[model samples]
Target: MTRKPALAVVGATGAVGAVMLQILSQHADVWGDIRLVASRRSAGRKLAVRGEETEVVALSEDALTGVDVALFLVPDEVSARWAPIAAAKGAVVVDNSAAFRMDPEVPLVVPEVNPHAVRVRPRGIVASPHCTTLAMLPAVGALHAEFGLRELVVSSYQAVSGAGRDAVALLRAQLSVVAGTELGAGPGDVRRAVGDDLGPFAAPLALNVVPWSGTLEEGGWSSEELGLRAETRKILGLPGLRVAATFVRVPVITTHSLAVHARFENEVTVERAHEILATSPGVVLYDDPEAGDFPTPADVVGTDPTWVGRVRRAPDDECALDLFVCGDNLRKGAALNSAQIAEAVALEIGPGAGDRRGLGSGQGPGSA
Candidate 1:
């Protein structure tokens, strides 16, 4: 009998990790003996997966024993230190962190857009793009395929959950302080009310949107804005694609939204673009403003597909289109992408791996 791959879900107690557990239960049964791994602090906690409660073991060399695939939903620093170790131990690591996305050898993949890239992982690690980039790329990639992408102008309205639990709590607390009040109507009113507890944001997130969401970069760009530009290029295989982006933190809970102005090589129209998106894999076209229908974060928070709406050809340019896309940051943006990559690796290794146990026998996808 062909043996199903054994899997490890690292950071099993994290926000994205929790969502990953839900995804595992809902996805096709392709794994055997699923192991949950977390920090020493989160160890011993029982988490449910595949209709069974599994105790999380502390992340260590032994925790990854005989694992065929490791889905890393941890922080950048943590992933940096551990993903290679997991990879070296024969597990193909699908990391959901900034640690490896830009690595020349690690494939930054969006399954719907760049599934082929997953097979060339020289480092035995696959990278998921930033949640902000994941929010819009499925639709964007569809449009680019038909029209030939030229440039992108994007502005992201990112939800707080992408910043982690503390940011979510900060936004909720600030909402309570400013609710039913004229706090945003006056200057410094909302700021004073929210006080100094920004919690990963540069400005108050109660009634206002902060123009920044990541560490500052050269030329005054934020890490997120630059990440959007870089990851989009890598995933789309467009190294020189012109992209300008601004990332903003909004008072939402779960989904990330993007307003994209995409310039293509050939002429584009709303009718054709609609047809393309409506049929694209992992994408939903919900563009009907007259009927009060358009993709919004509130409506897209829990959904798995990228919801694209308000799609229009630029009024002044036949080669450009404007779109608003929303995606649950924790799902497709993070956990779902990692899960998909791991699945791809499983399929690549096939069901006849025998005692090799996935990529650990010195036969990683990169050698494929």
Candidate 2:
């Protein structure tokens, strides 16, 4: 641990991976060496990282050699296959996939929330929560800490990009097809226009808000809805927390937005919730509807922090409060969280954190 940590960015050429490289450049000087890794087809390609053009290497044991922290920003299948390889090669793998998130041995970490969980990494690997969950977790976590959260109800307005590049292209194509159309172009019109360009989503995402996001699960709930319920409970240390979620895909490009109604053990007030979110580490408070100030995806697309607004106490339930939150799905929801985990890991391995060899039991801001 004497030397600076050597970082490896898995899936270095993908959408979230590119954002990871950009974040590394902006947050440079934390790690010593940076390695760009991608698929075999993209292995020989070059990518600029921290102003230097670095060659992309295929995921392999040799490529993972000497890597202190490996960020996997690939598909869940890829992570299921390659993350163990990276970890086996002495790298602390911070995975941004759904593959290992629910695994009891792998901790699903949000730096602003349960960072202390980073310690006891049973598999030497950590899982980053899905992007949609991150859209409001930081804000909710802060409020929960102060109010003793007991239940949650979240409605998500997710962007098309959350599905990936193909989904983005599908939305753009559909938008172009209806650019000059009239106002009331019904659901049938959108479905006919989008045709076969649905890509990953089950329905057309342009000019429409699909009530479903992620694959349909048992009991009529989507995977995204289930993920939000599970992840929030894990991060907040509330295994039996009652959570009701509805995930919808909106015709947007970047950020994910959520309307959260969180019920706490004690009564909550609009003023108190605002104060907690304002000073929260990863949350930005922007509530002032009179002055026309609220967090929107378009306004916060490229930002780092989770933007929170529309703070109010639920009229019917004194113990519940409402909030609207938005954040860049690709950055804070994916790449930034992975980088923060790596930074947290590095801190434990670095000088002032005390004996660097005890990373498994390391304790700090982002441990678990």
Candidate 3:
């Protein structure tokens, strides 16, 4: 309680990890000793934090000792393996991967929506929702609080940077190759014209939109679509909520936007929804189609708040409304969310943190 707690950032060399470092720098000083941690390949590399070049350490039992909080920004598989290890070493882990988002014990948290959930980490771990699920929380969550959301039809326009750093490179090269020729006129245009380096995406991403994001799952829906549905239901505490999503990858480099049609249990109008959103935290209302005042990835990239606009009532459904939302995928969608959760943990349990429960004293993940 008397001292700032030590913090560790796992996956310090990755995309989200880099953003996590930037966010921590921008936030109020809430940590004691900040350590940069990554895989063996990244270990020993230096990254500046608060004007100091911190050496990166490999993820291991020794690297995580005495950490009050371990903010994970690694891949799902890496987080699945190392997050528990970090927690066991006495750090309250706030994971930014999908590995534990749906876990019964791991709290899926977005501080603006459900901050109290951060205090009860049954596994000594808190999970951040997928980037797509998180992108809509502030705006949609504020509306749900007012109108009692019951159904959602969401379509996401995601950016390529969400895939990783290499995908960003591929997109830039493909754009140059297809500058004027109908821009991805046909399939394999990226591969035939540019090199065959589309990264993990299912289709070419030059000027074309890929209707798929994650792998295909049951009922012919892609896993990303299912992720949006499941994470929304979990975060909003509406287990039986009717939610369907279609995720499409766009050529943008950062920020993900969504077109949301939400039906509520009570009557709603665009005017009332705009009033609620304008006064809410972490939401920026920019709807004014007449003046062309709306938000795009260009408008919200590198920002933390969820930028919402185009508020209107559905023509046929009086109980329904429509809106557009945008958020920086790497910031609020991943790194910033975890950082906020960590700050909540610090405030709740103090510098001593969960030591009373065998966490703050550098104990292993108990029954984790």
Candidate 4:
């Protein structure tokens, strides 16, 4: 008989947390005895799991007891506070926040890109790459392996869900107002709109794009852009890798798309790049320009794989390639990536083994 691993999901009431539950439910054979944990305000709320309702428990020291793995989907503050305690208590933590992604000790992971990094977790926490970074990893790693990546330039068309649940609500409300206006509605209907309040965004997100995401950090880059730059370098094991990112908040509900141009150390052709991408794990090559085939957020939303298309060789082939990628920001970008890390950890630690001392045990306090 196989013993199922006990699991805890921090921030179980949040958007990514909810998707984490769904992904786990879909992969029940790999996990068992799941615990949904949230903040005090969300405690006691019931969430549906496999057609059954599970009560959410408050995230406390006691909640980590006996769990084999804990997946954190909470904000940076909450993750910073509780992840260490959870690790110390024996649960291996797979964190899906920016809090630990850049920490040298934490294995910033994308399973297809750096599964080996899982074995070097001096810090108990393993971090999922930022959504943008995660979306780009499969394809980039493939190219890197074949041609050696030297520099990367990326611009992201990010979805509102990347902002949070409130952003989704705000987008929906704004769309409703826009619909009313398009149908020839009055000023009262326009100005006193349902989504006039941009709680999750800095400006109106209904029909406009917001260049900023998270707070502005040093060098005019928003936290979101910096996360992409930093997490990409860490996961690819290229500390000095040259990367620049522009993260923009689009009106879409899910999936983030990236336009990337990368220069490689060795010469690479578009056809060769396509071949590598086709065989790479977690990447689906969709480059059929004749059929107008290219990845878009609308096509990738709710999907697990990173969809790739529009492959081209840069005019000045200083060994550079250009590509377009789209992926579900909530899935492979966040929730599924965390779950995959936990699965990898489980495989590394061996089936039914709950020891927390090993790198694969999914147990360790924060190294950050």
Q: After superposition, how far is residue 18 of candidate 3 from its true place, in Å?
A: 1.0
Error of 4 at 280 (Å): 0.7
Q: lDDT by residue for model 3 over 1-368, one digit each (tens)?
A: 36667789998899998998888888888777898989999899999887789999988888887777889888899889988878776678999988999998888998999887777777889999989888999888999999999999999999989899998988987888888776455666556776666688877777678899988798899988998888888888999999989899998999999999999999998899989999988899999999999999997999999999999999999999999999999999889888998888777656544344343443433322
Ranking by lDDT: 1, 3, 2, 4
User: For model 4, what is the error of residue 124's alpha carbon versus the real structure, in angstroms, after optimal superposition?
Assistant: 1.1
The CA-based lDDT of model 2 is what?
0.85
Cα-based lDDT at residue 120, candidate 4: 75
Sort by TM-score, best first: 1, 3, 2, 4
What is candidate 1's lDDT per residue for 114-184, written digit by digit as tens?
A: 89888888888899999999999999999999999999999989899988887788899999999888779
Local accuracy of candidate 4 as per-residue lDDT tens digits, 204-302: 666667787878898888888877778778878788999888878888999999999999999989889888999999999999999999989887899
Model 2 regions more than 4 Å off: 183-187, 351-368
Task: Show the colliding residue pairs in model 3.
Answer: 88-364, 88-365
TM per candidate comes to: 0.97, 0.94, 0.94, 0.91
- RMSD (Å) of each candidate, 1 decimal: 1.6, 3.5, 2.4, 3.6
**Candidate 3: minimum summed lDDT over ten consecutive residues — where?**
359-368
